[model samples]
Target: MSTPLWIFDTTLRDGTQGEGISLTAEDKVKIALKLDAMGVHYIEGGNPGSNSKDIEFFRRVRELNLNAKLTAFGSTRRKNSVCEHDVNLKHLIESGARAATLVGKSWDFHVHTALQTTLEENLAMINESLAYVKNSGMEALFDAEHFFDGFKANPEYALAALSKAKEAGAAWIVLCDTNGGTLPGEIGEIVSRVVREIDAPIGIHTHNDCELAVANTLAAVAAGARQIQGTINGYGERCGNANLCSIIPTLQLKMGYGCVSDEQLKSLTGVARYVSEIANVHMPVNQPYVGNAAFAHKGGIHVSAIMKDSKTYEHIEPHLVGNKQRVLVSELAGQSNILSKAQEMGLDVNPENMKSREVIDRIKELEHQGYQFEGADASLELLLRDAYGGTAQAFIVDSFKIMVERTGGAMVTEAIVKLSVAGEQVYTVAEGNGPVNALDNALRKALVQYYPGIRDIHLSDYKVRVLDEKDTTAAKVRVLIESTNFKDTWSTVGVSSNVIEASWEALIDSIRYALLGMDKDEYVPEFVGGTHGLSNH
Candidate 1:
């Protein structure tokens, strides 16, 4: 029999402590649903006493029929105040959460200096808070803030604090690496001792200041901690909290712990990406398990070996976590890379085909000219389809023009695009805040009528990199545009000396890819224009 390790996610609470991470009530609800669907044991909704947003989140979350228990976070009562009289404690109880977590100072230094209170008084605060929550018929968790440091400084005081919480009915005694400076060896040793002393279940919450949050968490689990507290994508204050993305797979696949169901584990990658998308954060390509580059093979030698035996390179199957193996095309790629990539894209092509060699040579030549296809798989697919003569031209740009002018102390930009779709000429003009926006507006206005599916496509991200910084304005710039139809996302790239030209090239490729994947029967013209009118030119 395997010991069950509970996954306690604090993404909604501790995660928002990360710099630039803010979540609306709706966003929090959406993430909670995703976490519940992924079989997380507990979801710390938010600190109910912090702000109106979090208070509202607790209220809104009650309406959700989630499988995971919702936990409300708060601090222990003030120095001399009774737990019943504390407003923070009142809010936590009124939040209607299934569980309540109260963080109290455990370190003797913090008790004496930070709180300016006696160690005995701090112990009373932890005990009284947990006792009150437990008496109210709710599960009480005591978070001993800075436990590792506290234990090292005064093991007597730290163990006394845990003893107090347990005696006062804390269901779980959580040790927090608040400063995030503890190593795995120290965590394992300390956790082993704490488990021997504390009678209740143990939990671990760690920060990533030393980049050892995951390591320390696993150490605690190895030493008998039953619960792991962390956030999705490691979003939290300072260096962030432990990443459940890495922790979940490690616990289930590597350690043989039944942290989540097999089906829930498979949704890990999609859920990670979903949370990042809702947080408006760029998903790191190299993130472990669920990242774009996690199982991506780029080198020729690596691709050759992986094609023959994936076990030679891959640690685990990508599909286990809802991620697919990617074969990237680049200057470093060989003929085998091309064939493998083609096969992954569902293209039937022989390795000996001359067209495969031509495509490989063309990719290398284009890369030499500053076009990198590694991050632009959509563009590479379009190139291959065109070379194979299997893709039909979506539209042809007859001409386009952009105008920038200053009017009444304000800069105004407009674009005129003339294009032919299915032998029909359509000319459109639109104004925007910038040249790229103007071009995007004009192009979408023209194509939305012919292909209503294009209306669903929108630019999610745009990035520009200069090939030669020394050349300044004359340098060739590479523009990468990420477009999405709310269901799928793809990246396309373009390079040119002129910034506008490069942006336009990437934008055209984006539109072409969006239109190429649409079913003709799904085209329904729905006008979505108002403030700035779309005009026929």
Candidate 2:
């Protein structure tokens, strides 16, 4: 590895700018602690000048012990205003942050158009604001907004902006690709010129407007920028900022640069997930490095090759990022896909066993009829076990009925479910806001008395997809139910012409899977594929 790369995380400040991302002050603190534990060098918390919430966050964060340099973000002192009287800079000092990052206009066009101030005055703003922050005993950093575009339009003026920051005792002169339009080659060239023309330490910040934020950040680093600034999962305004999730691993493992310790690097996946969860944003399944499907293999040929030599289809050992290889079973699956999935689940299905072949055929047949097992591990596991007669007959679901009344007075929906648990017939009735919920309640009411564990399983998310929209109302519906036992989560799937029936099928598998736990030692030779007739289900 080469020289250490300073990681400046702006997730708290910039990440919240992305649409649908709203983090509370508590959420910011939680994310900050995660970043601190993950060994980031600096964290640009938030702009305390504009948002009152950020002021509260700064006050709360002061009580916590953290290792990362916590910096408050704000623009330079207002144009033509005294730096000492600037409200933005005043808030930065009062916020109790250890450092302050001041963003100043660099592009000549923005100086004349946006700020409506003379270019010289903008330079003064950059200089005085940073100087005041530094004189206040806080580390001062300069963000040259639109530096790439400024350098393209007026190279001298852009370099002049950075010179003012250097003269103000700025600790890091960060070049910002604010518009995010600069390509990799141009970013490298401009950053290289800035590095040579200025005698200050260089940093890089970029957006994803053109989907090159990560690329531009890497370009700047390649051209002698020592610090990289970005956000977790690339959450920011417009297309978002450069993603630290991808940049960290690329720098540490692939580019021969030391960003985080190997142990800290392992926590990168967890950090990304935790931040996404708190931000209430869903990570794209194909997101690089940290997504659930990043290392998943679905093709039969790929699974076959990987089973023999994992390097054949994998880039790196997934465990390095705290993830694991996943084999997805579908119509595209081969015998190898079945065997690989079985191995992943710790099932002892032999590669040469005909039962394994039977399971593959069954999955393909079901998938042909519009069943998707990639997201329904519980249902697929049940199928695999049933083929080997390893699945125990826990309960038998019999007659079920739903009644919805919308005549005039008050709308009402009810469900009646009849099932047998250990030879004891159970009939239960329940009311709900909808048909599916009523059926879920009725079914759970019937089984909870016999199997108390059923009470622990609760549905987290429910999704239904139409297999053939051309069929319209007659189309087959695929229902996916995500359930949790408060300890572990699992997904199950069912498909039928009736949406309610599909939901019931998924609900049944969810309950059965939870009851069976998927850790059975018995693997009987006799098959019981259709043993659970689930009469009238």
Best candidate, lDDT-wise? Answer: 1
Instruction: Tell me the spans in candidate 2 whose CA falls farther than 4 Å from its real position.
Output: 389-461, 482-490, 507-537
187-290: candidate 2 lDDT, tens digit per residue: 99998888888999999999999999999999899999999999999999999999999999988788899998889998888888778767867667688888
Estimate, for each residue in 1-537, the C-alpha lDDT of model 1 and write its tens digit. Answer: 667999999999999999989999999999999999999999999889889999999999998878998999999999988987899989999998999999999899999999999988999999998999999988999999999999999999999999999999998999999999999999999999999978889999999999999999999999999999999999999999999999999988989888998899999998998888888887788999988789988999999999999998999999888888888999888988888887775677977669888888888888888998899877777676555554444566778999999999999999999888777999999999999999999999998887787777788899999999999889999999988765566788888899898888788778766666774344311111110111121
Clashing pairs in 1: none
**Predictions in order: lDDT:** 0.87, 0.85
Residue 160, model 2, lDDT? 97
RMSD of 2: 3.9
Question: RMSD to native for every prediction?
Answer: 4.6, 3.9
